[model samples]
Target: MKLLCWNIRGFGFTGRRRQLIEYLRQEEIDIVGLQETIHQDFSMHELQGLSRHQFAWQWLPSTGQSGGIFLGVREDVFSVEDMDRGEFFLSMSVTDRRVHFSWEVIFVYGPADHARSAGFLAEPKNKVERCTTPVVVAGDFNLISWASDKSSPNVDRVRMRLFNDCIADLALRHEGLGANLGADLRARKGALLDQIKVLDDLDDGQGLCPDGWLRRYALESSLMDIYKSEELFWQRRGGQNWLLKGDANTAYFQAIANGRRRKCAIPFLWDGDVLLESLEDISTHIYSFYKELFSAEPRGGVSLCADFWPLADQVSDAENADLTLPVFPEERMTAPWLRNSVKRLVRYFQLGASAATPLLQCSDRAGRPP
Candidate 1:
């Protein structure tokens, strides 16, 4: 699953939100953790509009004017089992429906204020300590861990040490830039291309040497292998169906995915005479429609016909006892069906040891049903 953790700074700007939404769509992020949203009050519709993705969301509204944290998981990908919100964090326990893997995800916007920083850092540690499942803690930490993280020498070493300690306590590792699968795939593809270029240069120098040609063939094979891996990576990202033998690159799949998303979106719905354009209106209409459609209908009591009892067959106590009797191994071997077993057992009981001799002999032999 692709997760995006971004401090979008202020999600209040219309243009910035539009660009972020476009980026989310392009990246095909399965879960997103957004920080520093300045809005104190907002709805899921507003979030869906801002991100342009259909997802189940939970958020911690901004305190005064500065620190909102939002976490959204694509509903198709995850089933939210539980949700919680803190002063500086929003958390959710989710299960990946396809694979049935469960995890806890926390989106934090750590306090920049010295007074609140300790509590913000400790909150996640406490939350993670109790979790039995895998955990993902992400978002704007607002704490610098090293001198290189800041531009100047004004780094807070105390806060950095505490943040590092909290991470250690939770057993969480940092995933820096180019740490994800897509980045690794791209890096591998680049390395293979570089190797191929080196082989091409050697071929130019050697002219028609057999050794140079052999090296070129080996490099070309490696390049093809990397190309296949890269193609598969993009195909998964684009969520497109695999195409038959052809060199359909990343751009082709991406374009198809974009088009598919557009086609699948429900912008508006007609509620009889009224057109529901807003998300709330459309959703409410759908909910109400289904509720009414499936609502219980009033009906009279069901009655059986007087003649039905006379037509139905009834078994006597003797017949029922025979039907319910447990079949012995000798009888089961002689006859596979329950009816045959009942008749055979009855006959064996009537004829005593002489009639059961053959069945006992068969059981003593191969023990297969004869």
Candidate 2:
């Protein structure tokens, strides 16, 4: 009954497709929902290759480059009864033959545009209501159910209300709602403080009941605990550096990360003497720069450094022969540890190249090698 959901953005690229396959294999997932595939068509061969012929999938192609979704069910585990596809979602009715159980699964990719998001939120209400089996709705809804769901300063109250209303209307449980209850609890505490103030102003010379004050104290304590737990959660997600010194505001941390990313981006780049702003121009400039940089020879002179530290004991002939033995293709592709290591290396290189690109461009513009 293990299910995995991811917004893969695009699965067309070879590296991403390989990574997805590796992840699926490693997690041993029974069912998977992938969003933002961006591919207009996928072949049976490609699907088999991606899933290693273990899972069967149904896909809704993207309209242009904007939206797409896919649902993959483990062929050995579930028998798919029917599939319904939409612009923003895909639903499948499946039965587990072993357990003799049935359920309806929906994978949704909500639109980013506000108006489209609203429509996406409302579109599935009827389908949800009509479903008789246990329904599992999942995917990148893109709309947060509460104000504090986003770390940015710009909290869309209207969108929050729409998202919450949609969930309530559909009678769906929001698993992450506990994280957003901090605000309501804090408001309640504030009202309690105001009531205490009014009680004090009465000057009855009789103190407030211990039970009422204890409840207020307990609420304040719970709020503080919630903040600490949230801070720890973000820290575990590798966001400690972006966290405020004393503040545990998740939204503020997100805003800081977003600001840093914006600041790091190359908005404009100099191509020879021309300043390029368009994405195409910028991409061309980067391509040309990297091509020349990698292809160019040493400017001053080439020098081969001699090995300074040599092994004290030379390898035996048997060891050298073993090293020279050819590696099999199956060994290269099927070895779990080797595949995982290569994937990690690929991810590292990709991230490093992106972060260093702007710095390298700046250095080249200043007539220096980077």
Candidate 3:
């Protein structure tokens, strides 16, 4: 079955709507999931205009002008057994008309707000765990699976880890265009190299013949295509943009990606003085450590004051006294990092908590960092 998942940006524009309908008809899309529709409602005629073939659809209204989700299935192809919606997602249980096979589909539009992202990511787990049928979850997660998934240098390692962990907990397979292209390039390279080798042996020690030379030229052209594909794949993996370079520098790009992988890897974990080298051991150690660390329940009447945060960085007593002392109206004091309330200080502690915690929990439960 064919499925199209897209962020339409908004479905309000007439031209865009017409173009989308035309494309849907041309492509014979069986299932559609659209995000950021902006509009809260659609008329029957308007819904019908999405495609000539009748469709069963479910949609969530945009919260203000910001976010929305729409899911549809061609009525002739599938029967909708059930449908549901949450603040961030639309889910449907569908049965195939031909095979009578059933599955669950969840189309999501993750929150754009970082503060709400944790709850958004956590929301699907309960639904997924309850499902007896196979599930396909797709949409714009507004997250990257890895730090290198985006071109921007400002990386949020914590968010990336949490997003990846959520995917893992859902038991979802993450695939991408670059991965498919990379696999195809490897297969093509193998075949091309074999053919080139055959041509080389055939032309061995012979005065260069036009037929052999032509065949070699064709092989060279194919090699160039492979190089271009490899370059594209590695460029994405390395998170680098290309300039007008005459040559495809696949090696350079691959090196950059490899360097990133190395920097992100933890070869071993220290458990007290002993190092955990085995995968199973490391996994157990981390799981046990964090499980114990956060297992503490809050006792009644327990609260924290500023100094109670022993591991948190502090303003010295002198600095505190200076701030508390009366100041002339003309005098001004500015602490740039501390300007934005305690948010930056709190975030700093969060990132640097490793100073106290020392070992980090692997990004994946399998004791491997991706």
Q: Cα RMSD to native, each candidate?
A: 28.6, 30.5, 30.3
TM-score of every prediction relative to native? 0.48, 0.48, 0.49
Off by over 4 Å in 1: 50-53, 178-370
Better of 2 and 3 by lDDT: 3
Q: Better model by lDDT, 1 or 3?
A: 3
- 10 residues in a row with least lDDT, candidate 3: 361-370
lDDT of 3 at 213: 73
Clashes of each: 0, 1, 0
Candidate 1 lDDT over residue span 42-154, tens digit each = 76577757555578877777877788887889888789999988777788999866434578998888887877789888787788887888787788888877779899988
**Largest TM-score belongs to which candidate?**
3
Instruction: Supply candidate 3's per-residue lDDT for 242.
Output: 45
Best by lDDT: 3
- For each candidate, the alpha-carbon lDDT, in order, equals 0.72, 0.71, 0.76
lDDT of 3 at 43: 88
lDDT of 3 by residue, 1-370 (tens): 6799989988998877877888789999999999999979978988887888999988999988989899999889899999988888899999866434588999998888888889988777677887899788889989888877889899888999998898788876676654455766786688768877877887775555887677677767767878987997887764544453223667766675788999987789998899989989988998998998989786778445434445335444443333334433343344542464255345446545534223222233332212
Structural RMSD, model 1: 28.6
Runs in model 2 deviating more than 4 A are: 177-370
